[model samples]
Target: MTDATRVSPFLGLPGAVEGEGPNAGAPAHYGALVAEQRPLERGGAVVDLGNLGVIRLRGADRLTWLDSLTSGLVRSLAPGESGETLLLDVQGRIEHAAAVLDDGESTWLVTEGTRADEFASWLDRMRFLLDVRVERADEIVAAVGVFGDRELGAAAPNGVPLVWHDEWASTRVGGVSYATTDAHPGRDWDLHVHLLERPALEALAERVRVGDVSAAGIDALEALRIAAWRPRLARDVDSRAIPHELDWTRSAVHLEKGCYRGQETVAKVHNLGRPPRRLVHLDLDGSLGALPAAGAVLHVAGDPDRAVVGQITSIGVHHENGPIALALVKRRLDPEAVLAADLDGEGITAAQTAIVSPEAGHAADVPRLPRLGRRSG
Candidate 1:
């Protein structure tokens, strides 16, 4: 569990609003949330991710051991390189996701603070005779998120800046994209995570306070994330979530990598079947003057009495796109269908845009063979 008593220095900045729930221990927004978003999207500001959990791994077997367990190709990751990986269950359901950065001597995994302890505990159980040693480094290091290619003077612990660049903007090597669209919104998404020590974090906070640097809150960052159709483990994942449903294979899963815990399921689903659900981007009706609450049931727009087809996972009012949301709907749902979210007794209409297409999966495209039958010639 995350330390509830831990307070971030970013919270002391002018117009800062303390976050709650999953965003606890961080600032939700500054006084001007919408205003703050524009700067962040343009790479003019940074978001404090100090609340995120950091885990450090040491020893010679660290990289190779991690490669055999997760869903990414990480054994060859060079020092200062960034990688995204997922820990999946035996059934191929997502268990954890991390932004990975290695510094030659030590490997760092930055993940949701709420799941840190459980993630670390599981890693410990799997370390039978490996040379690796896992330790929770939350108290020793923190993370900050930068929106673009701009540098923020990140700390270099082993002569390499401890930064993890997100690979969302393009298809990763050995990864396949599930989105059928020619232009992907994620192509414009540029995010970087910088790890820093306590003194550096405090110094960076001071820079924001004196107007020497700019800062945005998690709210702004979230809005942009939703607009980009990015799926976060904490928000978009459920008990049954597989990487395919969220199109995570584009970044986190290497299709040709050697077997891992869930390799069979991942291979079968990609070659012979489709994900049960598909992720979609929604343009919500803002005329009602409210955003649909997370987990609100969704139905076909004109028929509120119809069976629920999906639920809202993440919702935000984007600066450019008024009200937007990311949802996981039944795989068979029509891509052009108009949807509605049940807010109380009222239905707020929404236009659906496919992120993970209904046609996703079955990548191998094997052809059917003719069946032999007994006959007299």
Candidate 2:
């Protein structure tokens, strides 16, 4: 959220949608931000995602070392390539999420700002004998967001803007997914972050002033993300998180990667075990019920005293759809179950639209080898 000290470079631009709370200091709309962003063709919309933490990993062993710890094929990334990775705890619970892009010389990671310091400390402790030099790089380079197919209109680290293309918009290579929606809500949601500096910000500001690129705030950016069911660690993920619960295996968790901190639980959950909860999108009936805030408890239509079945993790106001939300609910809750969010003292109706299905364990489908070379008659 932007405030007195942390203002966006694009602040005070014409038609900016100023925001509050998580989007504090950021624009929610640019007068035309909502309408022009769908089909969202390419290269016009930009936002100051200064809130994200940028980290740089340099050294000969950087790639290999990162690959060893995170759920990504980092060692295989070529210059200018993009990948998403996750760090997990011993129990396979998600610890951190990074949108990564490599420029050969350095690996750039864009992550939640609040956890950057702690994440860096963890990396430092783990680099006992490695050649890796891990540290926060925001002071050297700022975080910027671009939502189109245009050239990154900023200074380049190596002929490019050190951008980390978002892969969560769709299923990526070497990953499994549970979303089966015929048409993904975010199919046109293409947003990436650029790591640059003050001069770059000036260059971007110049471009925006001439109508070269349109500007949107975190609110506009988030509404599209919610429409697509995209997950954000700061908003959707909490202390009790596991990759499977949010269907993150589709992009962040590489099931076939070498051993990492939480490999055992990741493998087990997708094979013999089931995620304790499932991710679901809710098209909230916004008529009578006010928008539920994060941590809002949910229940089956009229069952309040029956124990909370789930909680709202993220909420947004879609440009077209009145209000929408993503919630983590008990896995056994009927996909067709009528649900409601407790808003203030009222029960607002919601229709459950499943994202991760119960039958999502891709491990069960992993082809097995011949059993003892035995023949079947």
Candidate 3:
């Protein structure tokens, strides 16, 4: 991949080839990690989530202030509770994704490491009269994630103090979903992350070394994420992305939340029943022996010479699904349309069997729009 480098707490591990993508610059995976994915899915794997950033927020008005600023209902979050939130631009384009957790004394915001500084800067600028404190704890805290079903303490190792459990694997409580499958595959994903302090970081890595804990790399984690049709900010978003397109309404959004940045577009699109594009999961032909990477072009295979219509957002080699990818396709493209993904210069056939249906917004049918620039008091 790219020669760019990042620090890894588990740098001493074997087969750690600093990865690319969400866990970019971190160990991709250990040998044959994919073969052990089922055990991971069942709850016994710990991963060095160095690619994720940890931020600590503290202040009397922290919860309420954040509730007024984001798409999550964090104002009333109790101790040890976790939820997710999004910060969108005025046009309803997703700008920041945050995994929020509370520990009574502080609120923890877990997000991509690459964007933590930017997110912290934005948070600093928004604290006019609010009693809030925002600070990046990347130096003091490290992140570890687990895959499978188990108690938070058991699933998360090293006695990590903060955790944000997976909510996107299903239509989490309070979330309204747009998925059409009879049984959503992600209903069993069971992913979660734990935050540990610097001193304890090596302790956990030692556990993996001594065989007390099993470690998977970012590659293994990504396979499951892509197979579940999960979206990631580093891989899935372009500057123009809106929550509706990724079916983010299923989580990381509050349909009934009070006005915040981008509420207008969030409301308009969900009610009007339209999104410019839709998220689709593609089963790519594996005969080429090479999988398409993100940004690979998707074409309508039945059309003359295969016309370009979309581009892959995420790609992976899932243990069960084999070679698969996620793409943002033009919303109106027929569900049954034959598809192909250009892997490098080689064109590979693809089939669309899973998607966030085009008619997703049908459930929210707001008949009238408020006058321009008017908001209710």
Q: What are the TM-scores, per candidate, against the unseen true structure?
A: 0.96, 0.88, 0.90
TM-score result, candidate 2: 0.88
- What is the C-alpha local distance difference test score of each model? 0.88, 0.78, 0.78
| Candidate number that wins on TM-score, 1 or 3 | 1
Task: Select the stronger candidate by lDDT from 1 and 3.
Answer: 1
Candidate 1's C-alpha lDDT? 0.88
Which candidate do you rate higher for lDDT, 1 or 2?
A: 1
Q: State which candidate has the highest TM-score.
A: 1
lDDT of 2 by residue, 238-275 (tens): 88889888989888888887898998998898886788
**TM-score of candidate 1 against the unseen true structure:** 0.96
lDDT of 3 by residue, 1-377 (tens): 32234366576677666676566645787777576466566668777788887778888899988888887778888877778899898888999999998877788898887788899999988988888999987777777778643333321222334767877777756557777685877777778777776667777877878888877788788888888878888889999898888878888888887888898998888877688888998888999888777898888885767767888998878888788888999988889887887666677888886467878787456567789999898
Q: Write the per-residue lDDT of candidate 1 for residues 1-377, one digit (tens) a residue.
A: 23644567888899888776677667889888778899898889999985588899999999999999999999999999999999999999999999989999999999988888899999988889999999998777788898777677777889999889998999999998898686998899999998878788889999999999999999899899998888998889999999999999999999999989898899998999899999999999999887778788899988736889998999888898889999999999988899998666778999999999887895646785556774545
Estimate the overall C-alpha local distance difference test score of candidate 3: 0.78
Compare candidates 2 and 3 on TM-score and give the better one: 3
Clashes of each: 0, 11, 0
Best by lDDT: 1
